[model samples]
Target: MSEKNRDGKRSARERLAAERAKQNRAEKRRRGLIVGAAVVGVLGLAAVIGVIAAGTGGDDGEASGPVVAPSGAQGEDSLAIPVGEESARSTLTIWEDFRCPACKSFEQAYSPVIHELTDAGQLKVEYHLATIIDGNMGGTGSANAANAAACAQDAGKFVPYHDVLFENQPAETDDAYAQDATLFELAGKVEGLDTQAFRECVEEGTHDGWVEKSNEAFRSGGFSGTPTVLLDGTNIYQDRSMTPAKLKQLVEEANQ
Candidate 1:
């Protein structure tokens, strides 16, 4: 072989080796990132579990608020009140924090229309209670409100109490539900909801664990905030342009 030809071959071999080294490093970085993300995801899940466990296993004395799972809930982590026909064509899953002002606003703006659809058997609503504000604002009001709502459910009055609670939701920062008589007082607005049993359920903080679990489910649902409304698994408020008429239209489209 000629000297120039030999040199050219050697240069080509070097370039090939360099390219292989680059590819190897890139592959390693990609795998490292994946592992890092896995670890982060695991940690995030653990944190959620811890929060949920706080409701059932942690020291009751240390609990920031009341904690008890509601009886007859759909599951340990969910309390569903069907607001329409059993075989309704559409299901609206609502994840809401009672102390969230935005949720209250959404209720005030769209609840009337929601009622119309549900009453007509065009839609069913599955309400999921969450306590994002309690976690964020460091209080027990959200949990209390959720628990009271669940207690009302126990009395077969979930729908009415649900309406009344949102109708009376305090400012996000008010934490008004934490006050001693507030939850029961809200119940008074819902006929037949304020009674000895209902008062015990509210005062004793019956269903707090369910509230925590529901909030945990909300966190696990991969949603961004409270008042997360989903229509057949599609997020309806991703753009946040909310109106009762628009909601009715969405349900009609879904039904069609």
Candidate 2:
């Protein structure tokens, strides 16, 4: 073959190789774009789902059940049922969920000492009702119980009814207090709390809105859980090792 012909063939082969390389690179770029676009789409979808789940913004699921907040409810102070004279020097503020076992335990252990102090006009307690259990467990037990307690309060039977409710608290999973019948039955245990006025309040859920208000107040106070006890604005639960006796001692110390 002639040298010119050989040179032309070599140039042609080189051109072909270059063209193939360019095509492969173009194909790689196209594939990269497709894969990157798919990844970005998935990430965006996941971000939306996360925002929805994290309670940032979502569809509002309103309940049709009758609810009414207590009149003049402002904060934890307003939600309290006073156990002693308004002029008492020391105050005990307790935030409790009716369905919470820990609250029942606290009540059982401390009721005697607390009652003694309150009856002596040495201390007053302001009870704050929260419904966190209902929010987590998907039931109306906490709300119903708190509402009924409020009715008992309306009838001037807050202390007795509150004690009895905790005494007969249903298991966390049982959620028996959601039933109006159960609440009425429990009311019967507290003398004078089973009246017609109390019945209407419980049946109509007159204080259901109050239950929600109390919970909101709890959250607004930057609290994350229940049975938060405060004495003279001091958190009593800061010491995990404290006992009922210690609590009483704290109250006594505050009184002085």
Per-prediction TM-score to the true structure, in the order listed: 0.70, 0.74
lDDT of 2 by residue, 14-91 (tens): 999999999999999999999999999999999999866754221133324434544433333466656786777888
The prediction achieving the highest TM-score against the true structure is 2
Report the lDDT tens digits of candidate 1 across residue range 1-256. 9999999999999999999999999999999999999999999999999888864453343434544555555534345645677678889988888888889888888888888999999998888888888877878898888888888888889888988888888877898998759887888888898999988887787776667657766777789998898888888878557567787888898788
User: Which pairs clash in model 2?
Assistant: 68-209, 69-210
For model 1 the local lDDT of residue 176 reads 91
- Model 2: CA > 4 A from native: 1-77
Q: What is the lDDT of residue 134 in candidate 2?
A: 81
RMSD list, candidates in order: 12.8, 5.2
Q: Highest lDDT among the candidates is held by which one?
A: 2
